[model samples]
Target: MLTSPVDDEPPLTGKMQPTNVVVLGASGSIGEASLDVLSHLPPKRWQAWGVSAHRQLGELSQRLFATGLRPRFIVASDPDSASMAQGMPWPKGSELLFGGDALVDLATHPQCDTLIAAIVGRAGLESTLAAVQAGKRVGLANKEALVVGGCLVCEARQVSGAELIPVDSEHSAIFQCIQGSSSPPRSLILTASGGPFRTSTGEQMRQASVADALAHPTWQMGRKISIDSATMMNKALEIIEARWLFDVPPSKIQVMIHPQSVIHSMVEFVDGSVLAQLSPPDMRLPVQYAITYPERLECPVSRLDTLSRYDWEMLPADPERFPALTLGFEVAAAGGTAGAVLNAANEAAVQLFLDGEIRFTEIVPACRSALENHHFEQHPTLQRLLEVDRWARAEVQRWHSGTRA
Candidate 1:
């Protein structure tokens, strides 16, 4: 969770000039951690230029109070939930913007040097693409953006010379290890904590309750992602993210259930040397890394105790027990619209499972059905990808609601 560990304390030598930051999902777990990192830095070094919340104003307000930083701009995507943010305590001169397009406006603002695209799901796509197109350094934690529109995001970055620093712990580890390497990696190994049901048998998993699935073992995460972790579907989406982020074939990516959650990820080179990034499972480390990318700073998170006895272990994931692992590789191999359908279907299915509309075991099967039922395109346009995304969500709903797919 703490991205990669830094060996030395970063020099705090100068009166840091402010670097404008816009956090898209200011209320979410990742966004809040990012804010925490910003607060630790000298105010001159970095500042919260803008922040957005979908709902959760009370939590956002607390975060603002803790940081002692009032962002210049704020957006609330939920219209009715917040008719206006004007009534809240502010440091004065802060502009409160509304509606969906406000995300794009804030992301692509001339003053915004860094964009934290932490908004979850495909809903974050439009603003994320806007940031990429504007050539801003984007700290991407929204798995759906890459999973649903990997081509669009990568292609836009290539054309615009924008830097996409992955914020997810696993991808961040891979990013740090592969830096300045001469040769390409042989494969990428993403570590999974195995969630709460990591050791459960197939029969036992089928009977898991929502409360059980939400009880993640190692990390505290959002509800939807928590369930995805239990089902290992989050890793599946990350498989797609790795493909786009590292330019690796699906075969070059592998998943290993590291129950300890100490080793974030590992990269194997052609020479058989394995490069691994290990740290305490703290989300702030990665968020801090992304915020201060290309510059390693001292982290507030704890470092690994080299003197302590270690019982590190990694086991091959049981495909029979956690079938969602197969779906990711399958989607990655298929490419194009397959990723879109799979990501959207999984999102919808996870929500259904959360609502108790569908059972925990039904999540992956619903996603599989959507992918199988949808039309597959090898090279899909953005519009085509979005079309498939909507269809997949609808298909999952129909499948669960007893409508024809």
Candidate 2:
């Protein structure tokens, strides 16, 4: 059963003092935006405890120095023994630590009141789980963590009093929509821009190149993610993520195509009322929301002006056009290790397609094939999830080699 840390809401009231924060994946898109949000906050209350980046040590150091708040720790996930964190003075006895493992250490640091799990992909899983286990309030942008090990992470949150606020714009919208509603939502509708090729035929999709796939219509993201968006696989993975995040079954979750990308998500109650969260497509808005929940900020990234002249339309997602969504709902319904295997296979297949080794259409097929053939572990442990992830990656490799050559 899904659980919420209701017994540990910390009273939800005060002068709203800023908490000491550690930002994992400090060089990524969400991380950079988080730094911007942090910069806007009252400095005396808020402190940047640490920043961790995959390999952008120089850039990370520059950002830290520019903030003028020396961090207690700085980490580089790359292992050249590079120490950009060194020489940045800390208050009194504060220390600077460098190295790959420092990411995990700082994530669960004793002094950090909040940790932003913005690291993308499976690389972020361990650090995110560590922060949750340590009971730090985690703003989770890393959906793959929940995708791979939602049950385990949910269990950890129950035990550790960690607050896992959804940072993805769609999930964040759903989170906001469900707040204070008297009735349980009958359905949750997640909106999608359908990426760049929402209407492309199967034949056209088979011919789609990486450049074509990465041309996302509504949002700017990294290459890997943009490609995932094009295939609609990102939304597929999100279905599974949302299932765990909201504790709702797959049957209650719905995906709708909203090409304008204005309405992020909506919740329909049994009383026939729908609560929708609408906003301009900006990651900072959701990032700010996650940081300052239960309070509205005076400044926002962007707002939707309903009175302003705008053309909008919502359409039922055509399963014939996008098979990934169907595959997502199916895998999510399957539960157990299927989520892990599906995500791992999609990750691998996306990489192969991006490398020009597979067609865009093949991404979903590869994932479906992996999901169908894999042996599902009924009750999965963390080790079991990892094992399934590993096996799926290998399965994708075998499929790629056989088909590509």
Candidate 3:
């Protein structure tokens, strides 16, 4: 369980002043869910102070208009997108900023009481770190930040007293189950939906197309994430994240295949009891919880139909089918340059697969090759980690091109 003292703070309630939130990667799926969650919340209790989009200025504008949120800051992280934003119908009283540096600026801004880090891939790391260093309550959806640089983020949290609340449904479920516990949990159990290829044979996955990989059974996510899910690398990254988030060893963390996606996650006690959080597979529930933690609010998501008959299934994940799970455990235990290399290599390989350069089955092998080839550093600075990330991506490219010895 999390040992941070920041959890003791009073929950954000209606009686308190409106909490200003900055949603980074406001163009992505998680960001869209966050906007919906904010829109449904009482306006007097919460405000969208800032929002950012990398290349989807149009989509971001549409979301802003639909939600009727006039955030104080609108950031266009891509230069090309910022150039076209000169004539966009931005909300009045909103200051428009350009470039990636502005994201870090808004994250550490004084008015930012909370920041929702939803940016995908390694692009979200700097701003997410900036928010934690500035002592803001962070709703962390960008698991890559913790996967690549968990040590730095955890260390900064200790120094700045930031509250790192999870927005991922699985981690959020684990956080909820461990609350007010009398003793430390014996193990943390994370559940997976097994992606679209769960029931398919190994040969089917080897021949899977981009469309097949993106067809997630239970969740609607962006392209990169959908590919990760298909390969079970998303769960692998989450394993690395859980190791740092809860301050637990990799040996104490476990993953189970739950096709229903109802039981998000579980916590096992020392006395042989398990506490699980079951909810409909809705991201809004966890997003709302991260925003108004320790205080449950009426969410807009539909409730589970307890009156109807339902079947739930839990099975052991097959290591033979999902090789990425082994890589996840290896990175979680190795803890340094290994994570940066695995994440970058996986990202590059996924992109290669999507672009028709490699087979879906080649992704995990590429990640493993990069992880084994990278120099093992027990303790690495942020700069060193970034260097490893770049090196791993290049290595994957070289490996695909048959240039590496």
Candidate 4:
């Protein structure tokens, strides 16, 4: 009948193909949401090429069996060094890789077209670099990769022609706003939820418990990230991430306190026009965008209703109140070994604080001490970075324990 639409279309049965993808940190919040999105994608749109987790073999196995999508490779970043004869296990046809080097190797695997860098903290740095060096389209959820080695990451991206797409909601919003603009914007305005302690005074923060800190008002996230939000350390780290991702200076990136988290981020053009992306506070929306770059795929997350009257406010972040914010910008501007040390120190301190070993205020102080004591090494090679990361961890532990002793 009138040359049917199906007849006119090319045969998709054998033609259209999905990109091969890897999900690093596949057991985390972002990873879970990513899997949800991947499960929904059309067969011709995307495929899960590999999956990785730190140490969740049972959970990982169940997830793989449920999806019926066995990756060619699965990585367990944690391994028992004492049992050298133990075999890494996965689905019958899949291979299991172990340890940090295995993570890097899997990231740069020849079949990987896109890498979802969701591994948290500084542990993500090497794998992220490996992905970049291999010229894979990187869905960068790992902020520490940029935080600890922004210059190196930026350089790698340039050298290998890898595209770094932002997966964080704030960064994702700014990314969308920048896409339509004629040129680079005058400033990138990242929105902060002010966390659960937005209204709490500095004295209140001192008395804040882990339970208080973890009770995020808007978004669901991991323990470490929740604590980062409480101290506004998340915003601080985003400052560094935005610096490298956008190739903008810390001065050009601004943070606004938006307690509702309705407006993820905004971009101010040179002519005074501000473009912002507003959506419901959901990680899936941003995760979807990262997965399908240059294409706006359909997702379940909702958009803000512009017709309704909504209150939105912007305020300067007080660095004195949240020293974590200052330390973030300081490390970003300092460059070299500072990011490695700051990240490692904060990771240790955050864990200690979570364990109720230190006061909330001590988090920033411990990080500051670590940064100060760090031996400056210019042009840090990968080996040097690893050394500094280990050194910072030891130093933070020593200080934390000595203070208690």
Candidate 5:
């Protein structure tokens, strides 16, 4: 659940103003984790002005009740969830915001200076874009915005000079390691957990159960992301995100299978030296880091003091073992609307796989098929990208249903 940590705290006097934050997808695991992080901030350092939840209205309301914060507004981005949350007890003087437009409105709200864009999938693109256009400091929790709308996002940042701090661990790791550096690194290395299927064979993965796929070795995540991790597609999308976030060519970004999941990511300089960011496998560290950028705040969660006890394990990403990782590199290399098509197809395929409508192994192949079949657009306008997004989703659905040519 999301939080409004500003309620109990008194104002800061000198050089310590709070960040006025708006959280999108306020009911997910990330939202829940962010609440914990926000609660620990020195009262004067953070203020959650608004929050938007797409589903789980009951849970959202319960969490909101605990905070005793009557926010400026709360958004239910889903119609049914909106109706449900409206009936739930809210703090006095609280106003309700509904639908995508409401989310956009809040993103552009003058009071909201920081945005935690966590609304998942392509659904998160518009509000994220809105935050960027409004020049809000964006702590990006949504990968789809960068994956499907990287070009649009890049253009907006160039025009508005909006700051995008990645909430994803991998990107944040790279961001931290590269700090104080004037030049770009020679290459980037993103680490993966190898997921639950890291050691499973292709036949075993093909026959893997939905429950099996969701059993991630590390990282408690929502269903879609957990499944994506199981298939290594999350890494793929992050590869694309890193390409845009860091302004690097696809060849410079590499993925390594680190089953321990200790080292978030690494950076290799032009020289022989390499730098890496180490933290306990905690999402709040990065989330807090993004919120309190340029300054690391005292977090509720402490770090592992014994650094030399555990051995670090790292291995090359086996493309044959996890084809989803390949898709990200492919999309990164291709750029343009190819990312939109690939991401849309993967979104559809993952949903279908979750619903038991498609086999576990079919998800990546389905995305590849959609990418290959789409009319390639080297340079696409936002409208063209949206058109391709819709086309790819439809094609994935038809193909999943055995209705496509």
Candidate 6:
């Protein structure tokens, strides 16, 4: 059984009482965006209480210094980066901690009102789970935490009464649309930008270089995510994430290629009503929404200009071109160690592609091979999931080596 925060504590009433936020993965794109959101939010309503950097301690320190944001605790999750942080000027009065466990410590700390779990990949799973277990309001930007262990995280959230709010633009849009009606949503429609290769031929994609794949059309994102987008694996992963986040069946969730990306997502009701959330491709909007739920504040993100005529297009996603969608739906429906395997395999395969160790087209096949070969478990513990994660990663490596040999 997990413990929760004090029930008797008074709720936030005014701007005078600030919400203390712990942003894990404080050096990543999402982290930087989150920090920007926090900075723009009224100072009395939010504070950067704690932050962590996996290996970008120097950059994190520089960002903090530049922003003049003084967090109470600064964590360097990679122990090797401790020396790099030694010379960097971190904010004054910030106690610097080192190693992965420090992330968990900051997550479950009593003062942390909201935890922004933005660490990329499986490295964030444990701390995100800890925050949920401790009943912290979690702004989950790390989809892998749920993709890898949705059952465990959901179970922890249920037990601790933790609020698992999504920071992903698509999911956040769906979340916003669902809040409008008292009726249950009939289905969720996830929109995709179709990446840089939406119009590229299969042969063209097969010959795509790292530069080609990372050239996203609308959204600016990190390399791993950029590749995932180009391959449509990011949408696939979002499919898995939406399944768990909305507690909706995979069949009820649909993906459409919206090249313009003005419509983030939509939700259909039983009455044949569809509500869509539309905005420019800005991450700060969703990040800010996750931080302040049930309340809308003035945001720094650019507003969608209604005066300009727009050409918005939504097309059916072709799973034949992007096999990763098939894998995502399969993993979501399987609901066990399958998700762990798929996430780990994709992460490994993406890294391989980035390293030029694998072809652009090999990423999905590699994930599929691992998912198909792994042992299926209907119910798995956290340790089992982690073990399966490692096994799947190794399986991808073996697949690569065997393919080259």
**CA shift of 27, model 2, Å:** 0.8
Over the full model, what C-alpha lDDT does candidate 5 score relative to the true structure? 0.87
Best-matching candidate per TM-score: 6
**Candidate 2 segments exceeding 4 Å error:** 1-17, 65-69, 81-96
Greater lDDT among 3 and 6 belongs to: 3
Prediction RMSDs, each to the true structure: 6.2, 5.3, 5.1, 6.9, 3.7, 3.1
Clashes of 5: 1
Sequence-dependent TM-score of model 2: 0.90
Give stretches of model 4 more than 4 Å off: 1-15, 65-68, 81-93, 305-308
lDDT, candidate 6, residue 302? 90
Worst 10 residues of 6 by lDDT: 1-10
Tens-digit lDDT track of model 2 for 1-405: 101232243643466655778888877878887887787766666667777877766676666666565566667677653554454433343454556577777877666788888888877888888889989888888898888888888889999989999988899999999898766789999999999898887788889888889888989887777887898888888898899888899999999999998899999999888889988898888887777777777544766786799887888888778888998888778778988898899889988887888888899889988988898886798888888999999999998787767
User: What digit string (tens of lDDT, one per residue) describes model 6 on residues 1-405?
Assistant: 112333245666665779999999889999999898888888888999889998878788878887778997888889998888777787778878888888998899777899999999888899999999999999999999999999999999999999999999999999999985888799999999999999999899999999999899998887878898999989988999999998999999999999999899999999999999998898889999999998989888899998999988989999998888888898899999999998999999999999999999999999989987988999999999999999999999999999999
Model 5, residue 70: displacement in angstroms?
Answer: 3.9
Residue pairs with colliding backbones in model 1 are 1-282, 2-282, 3-286, 16-44
What is candidate 3's lDDT per residue for 1-405, written digit by digit as tens?
112232364655556779989999999999999999999899888899899999999899999999989897889999888778877998888878888988998898766799999999999999999999999999999999999999999999999999999998999999999999979899999999999999999899999999999999999898999999999999999999999999999999999999989999999999999999999998989988999998899999888899999889989998789999999998999997888999999999999999999999999999998988888998999999999999999999988988334
TM-score of every candidate: 0.94, 0.90, 0.95, 0.91, 0.94, 0.96
Provide the overall lDDT of each model, using Cα atoms, as 2-decimal numbers. Answer: 0.87, 0.81, 0.92, 0.84, 0.87, 0.90
Q: Name the weakest run of 10 consecutive residues (lDDT summed) in model 1.
A: 1-10
On a 0 to 1 TM-score scale, where does candidate 3 land against the true structure?
0.95
Model 4's number of clashes is 0
* Local error of candidate 1 at residue 353 (angstroms): 0.8
Summarize candidate 1's per-residue lDDT along 228-251 as a digit string, tens digits: 999999999999999999899999
For residue 39, model 1's alpha carbon misses the true position, in angstroms, by 0.3
Error of 4 at 65 (Å): 4.3
* Candidate 4 residue-wise lDDT, 239-345, digit = tens: 98998899887888888888888889999999999999988898888888988989988886777787989877777777877788888888777778888898888
